[model samples]
Target chain A: SQQGEEDPQALSIQEGENATMNCSYKTSINNLQWYRQNSGRGLVHLILIRSNEREKHSGRLRVTLDTSKKSSSLLITASRAADTASYFCAPLTQGGSEKLVFGKGTKLTVNP
Target chain B: DAGVTQSPTHLIKTRGQQVTLRCSPKSGHDTVSWYQQALGQGPQFIFQYYEEEERQRGNFPDRFSGHQFPNYSSELNVNALLLGDSALYLCASSLFRGGRYEQYFGPGTRLTVT
Candidate 1:
């Protein structure tokens, strides 16, 4: 299964604190994407890290990828209550056209 | 610009009935994909359509099918629905830039099979 297995099935933190989630996959990938889903609604794409890239930052979000370990991590800084949601990671395999195989995502809660 | 949009935000149908869900991709997107997300589970890919034809499929059964229109819109149809078919149906769209592109998801249509 090439599904990206997210770690820390659930996490709780205070507003202004940072939250981190990890994902591990079983196969090589071209890139990894992180998304946030609020209350089980539509998912909002957060960031994407290519295989050659080690780290990338977008506003308050930071993503790191370690292809050697077949793992990736997403970090949200200065979290707000609105950040409370399920975070999913999709390890996109090479040659597959957006056929994302997702694993159970990490649920994060930010207490205001 | 509008993102992906799905119709019939919610639906309720009895087992053995058929249901059709619709989706319109974001502007300029040429590919459409469908997924099923059960309660408390990650979304599972059903199939993907490009150029109005199924370019790739997941492990889903034939009972789960889809079509893409020339205008880049798509529809997902399930025949003889089962209780287990109740889930959040999500439609995503993206441009097939060779292979790598971000998918914009719709709000999804929640289906209940009773």
Candidate 2:
């Protein structure tokens, strides 16, 4: 079973606009990580937010974790056409060796 | 530094046949994990290898097995493959500290079981 579920299964936006996707999980997690997958490729690590941290930033990406809600969100500011890809949120399980369980993912399309 | 690398970027096989995929971890990393991703779906954990041993695995059946070499490279073997087995196989490498959990991924091998 998937530990997390992301909302807005698909999102379409114009370049330079901001794209935000949210994920909700069922169990407690030690940390949450976000990844991006281009078409026909493996995933690329984006950012990671530990349970203790509320927010993190890297370049045009921003992520926030709310442990109380067991949810997290990824924000891509000033999106580019190249930013088009699928975004996934994977939460590390608390017990059982810290393996990650992924959500169904949100597909984002940035139109030029 | 080279990131994780996988072999046979793409492959096609008939159902019931066997297939083996390989992966070399990223430089300086020691742990390796495998994932299977179907079309339009998120990747699912297959198993993880560390120290030349199977450490943890996902819900996959016994047909899915793996081996890790001393150099930290690994192989994922699927026996009696099914049409459902077709998917992208991804290999990720990471270092296991006490509680850290960051993993780097390879470009992935696209497997199509016809």
Candidate 3:
């Protein structure tokens, strides 16, 4: 069974707008990572936030994690048509296992 | 350096037949993991291999077996394929056995079972 679930199964926005996607998990985790997948392609790692961290930023990507609430959010600012893809959140288990349980993911479309 | 790579970009198979998918981890990486993603679902963990051994596995059945070679490359074999088994098979490579390490993924092999 999947441990995490992402909200807003799909989102559509115009280019240059901001896109935000949320994910919630049921178990304790060591870290949470986000990924982006283009159509019919593999995933690309976006960012990872440890349990002790609250927020992180990389270029136009911002991620916030609320361990108390067991949730995390990804914010993509100045979205581009190239940003259209599926986004997934994966949470690592507390046992320090190499496996990462992933959420259903959010399909984002940035129209130019 | 090349990222993770998988072979046979696409495949078609019949029910009850077997299929083998291969993966070469990113340069200098040691661990490899496999995942299955349905059309609209997230990628599910199939198993993980480390030091030429099956370190951990997900809830998949015995029919889904795998092997890790001495070179850290891996192969996923599904015997007696079922229609439901048709999905994108992804191979990911990580540096270590812990969760803090980042994983690099391959383009994946799309399998269509008849």
Candidate 4:
């Protein structure tokens, strides 16, 4: 059992629809981050939300953090075919070396 | 400015052999971290180096070692590789503030062990 766990292993949706991904962690954290990986490519950081922060937004992405529940969510509004990729949630532990522990991730496919 | 960069995009190694993977941190980022990602799995933290010191390590064995230079470049050396050692080695770099940072990752090096 790693620090983070994400559900909905795979999702398929039409273009212009919204996509939501959820992640739950075992312990408290300093911050949580989301990343995107296209096929056969390195991951790209999408956004970060500190523990003290409940919600944050960037572009079409909205992230929410529930510290008491040890869970977080990422929402992509009006997702496009270009947004198709695997998304992961990383929870940075409170006492660790500032390294990020990632979840398995959710595979998102937005059909054109 | 250039993002994080790694060398030898793909490599093949045999069991019990040694492999060295190199990484150059992003501009202005002084900390380097490494991870191993197997097929269909998320990246697992291996270790992190900052200021030419091993700041933190994950649950990996001693066969996995790393070194950081004064210029914020890093090298990951794995010895006595097993078949399970085959994976994508990723290097991420970020500025070490008082606490943590959001990492920027390199394209990664794929290591296949026979």
DockQ of every candidate structure: 0.66, 0.57, 0.63, 0.59
Best by TM-score: 1
* 2 against 4, candidate with superior TM-score: 2
Fraction of native Cα contacts reproduced by each candidate: 0.63, 0.50, 0.67, 0.59
TM for every model, in the order presented, reads 0.97, 0.95, 0.95, 0.94
**Candidate 4 C-alpha lDDT tens digits along A22-110:** 99988888888899988767889999899899999999999999999999999999999999999999888653347887778999999
Which regions of candidate 3 are displaced past 4 Å?
A95-97, B97-100
lDDT of each: 0.91, 0.89, 0.91, 0.90
- The number of the candidate with the highest DockQ is 1
Chain B TM-scores per candidate, in order, are 0.96, 0.97, 0.96, 0.97
- How far is A84's C-alpha from truth in model 2 (Å)? 0.4
TM-score for the A chain of candidate 1: 0.95
Q: Write the per-residue lDDT of candidate 4 for residues B1-114, one digit (tens) a residue.
A: 999999989999999999999999999889999999999998999999999999889989999999999999999999999999999999999877855457899999999999
For model 1, residues B1-114, the per-residue Cα lDDT tens digits are 999999999999999999999999999889999999999999999999999999889888899988888999999999999999999999998888755468889999999999
lDDT of 3 by residue, B1-114 (tens): 999999989999999999999999999889899999999988989999999899889999999999999999999999999999999999999877444467899999999999
lDDT of 2 by residue, B1-114 (tens): 999999989999999999999999998888999999999998999999999999889999999999999999999999999999999999998886645567888999999999
